[model samples]
Target: MRCPLARMTAETPLRYRFVGARGVRAWIAAPSVAQTQTPPRPLDPTEVETIAIIGRPSSQIAETLRRKRAAEVISDGVSAEQIGDLPAANLAEALQRVPGVAIEREVGEGQFVSVRGLGPLFQSVTLNGAPVAFNENIRNSTQSGRQFRFRALSVDLLAGARLAKSSTADMIDGGIGSNIDIETAGGLDGGPFLALRAGGEIEERTESLRPDLSIAGRIVSPDGSKGLVAGISQEDRRVRYDRFQIMRYGAFAVSGAPLTAPNDVRTTVEREDRRRRSAFLGADWRVSPNLKLDFDGLVSSFDNTIREDRLCPPSAPLRQIEGSV
Candidate 1:
């Protein structure tokens, strides 16, 4: 049976009823209902096709997740694409994005890394599962630990970096905080790849523009059994620093209490010229599915030259300077 409301039409007339003294006080009008129509049926499914999407950024993200999941210990990885996306000057700066990772800066660039609130001495750095020699600036010998300086290496020479926070049986023993493994791409990792970069940066204080150039490429054999990767980069930069120095502090009696004042005030201006060059070569050989040999070698050089000028202003003698105490 159809509903009563559904039988109502739009053309229904109005009706009025009069009570004893009210006289046609209330007037009722027929209610109008909107018609409802059935919705269209969905189309039938035809055929199913598979689509594979591959991109540099997306592939790198997928690979990072895969590496993180496959590791037996607690590990985090940063891909080259991710590192390149950031405005970092060195590998140490790029690594600051990872959890529990911190960097030490020198000369306005990241030089060392500390992991999990521990100093660099407690952390170990390796390249392709092998220990790399520690490289430091000759001018500074204060860093006498077995720490690896990240500033010595360029980010363009790396494919990815992984930090393992937990210990495992197959790892080296020196890392009490964490172990960092730097990975390089194999020649066949991507069919064929080449990158070239040339740019210039201007210093704020000096207003001088410096040039930076880098080139990297990979070549692989037909059978994909052998591959070679090589990259080189050079950067020339000039940095200036202005600082105020207080050689000593002295106490003087003012009114009734002793007051502290700076003694031997001096101003210094320092200009530094830095030149860095880095190169890396990698080889991947798949002798068999179970046995493979990978070789990665890196060479880097850094030159630093600094010139400084100082100006000192004479102050009152310490013996009677504002009633010394």
Candidate 2:
């Protein structure tokens, strides 16, 4: 039980070396064979060359055609008008020129907007793309009636407002009145723009110096992919109202006494003083070409006080009767 080993010699044929396990135990080198192919060489500078061919140039002709088409498109959908320069305080006044629009003034200032006879209460007001309808707690009291007031809304935050006469499913409903879309400076399609305004007026009767101030700005990225807009506005106004009236009353004496005067006379006087202040801020973020995010906030304060005085004749015949009765 002995294992065998293979050995090779120069005279042994390579193919017949595996006759037995002992014949395979040796190393052998194969003869070299000639190659039929050669390696590729790099191309020389003189062998490489550039070819330039010229064709008819039409860049100028194409540009002129594009400009003419653009002008036609712009003319079809937009129109231009020369509106005289107006102060910020009178912005609403300027907007009155638009068709089917109306404005209401409170204390000689534009405080309410109406579209096509629709009242302000029913219409929705928005700053940029956000609604400005925040819950406002207003308290009203009457001597004879229950104390109640409506939610007070203000348009001081708007740089401009547009009226949407037609209705769309996407827009808010319940308004038979036209929609008043307020435009704040911070939300504009154009690049960044800034504006600031401040002014005051004097009351002839009260001699009060009422003042107003506002600051607004907008910024857009150079690539038009991102933008930021912000605005803050404040207004202070004072109003005074007065009324005077005289009344005469007639009554019969209960007891048979010499009736010198059977009628009573009185004079009444009433005065009201009001002060209002409002402020607002808004922002917009264009997250993508089809999606946008917006936020807005506003605060307003109104204080009003009324004073009344009455004067009646003392010891009049009617007064004496009333006292006796």
Candidate 3:
């Protein structure tokens, strides 16, 4: 008797299938079909070159000009040192090129930036076009003897900054020294553009490495009705500073029979490490060709720590720690 063929079902076990059998052989023997190939299209070298040469469109150029103008206005008349580069570690370093701006260094690094003849506390700093006033607990006062430090604000977040020496009704009421305005850009253009910058420096005296990075981009719709822009940056830096402090004694030396030494000598050394990070986001709605509505948001954070030590010879006992750390 002939062997019976097994019936196939959707759920049949794999090991039970019939192989090399009469029914399977007929179903598996089918002829192969041929596929036709299409000819390749030729590349137009001229068109490719033209597209490359055209590069960014005219609208993009205009947007670039606008940004340049804004930066120039903010830096106008400022010294090269003061405005050396936008993303400096602190206002003092940023303003070093400006005339009348003085920076006190500790251990060959900038400790504080002084404007005109005013102290650090006398200066006011603004962020994102808004004033960053001191809290009630940290109010500004001469007697308080506390001052603002440039390291407190993030340099990365600022696309541009302006130092205003003269007073204006629109500015903060206080600050005989100067006012610092920090601005952020909103990435709201409907075009595709990208910008990236990074650098690192090694200081010989401090033996420290400084590194910085920044990225900015914009996306705009073809119709130009809407756009988005954004920027982000971070920096890590170390600075050294050295300076002298003067101490006076014996105010009534002329009248008194015996007077203490009229003056004392002292030296100070300081080391500072700072880290900063910042981000900005902005959107634009084109209400009209010449007029548009823009909204921007910015966030920035900075951390700075200083280490100071004083040394004097054993014979010169006059040197002593005077202030609380």
Candidate with best TM-score: 1
Clashing pairs in 2: 5-22, 6-22, 6-23
Model 1 TM-score is 0.75
Computed on alpha carbons, the lDDT of every model, listed in order, comes to 0.82, 0.50, 0.61
List candidate 2 stretches off by more than 4 Å: 1-98, 103-114, 117-157, 221-224, 247-280, 284-325
Candidate 1 lDDT, 172-219, residue by residue in tens: 788899999888877657766889999998999999999999999988
**How accurate locally is residue 126 in candidate 3, as Cα lDDT from 0 to 100?**
71
Per candidate, the number of residue pairs that clash is 0, 3, 23
- Model 2 alpha-carbon miss at residue 119, Å: 4.5
The parts of candidate 1 lying over 4 Å away from their true place are 1-57, 135-143, 250-261, 287-291, 313-315, 318-325
Q: Which stretches of candidate 3 lie over 4 Å from their true place?
A: 1-87, 106-111, 133-147, 152-157, 188-192, 201-211, 238-273, 289-291, 305-325
Summarize candidate 3's per-residue lDDT along 44-147 as a digit string, tens digits: 76644444445654543354345546652332233222343454555556666666778766434455667878867777767655776442333334355435
- Report residue 129 deviation for candidate 1 (angstroms): 0.9
RMSD of candidate 1 to true structure, Å:
8.4
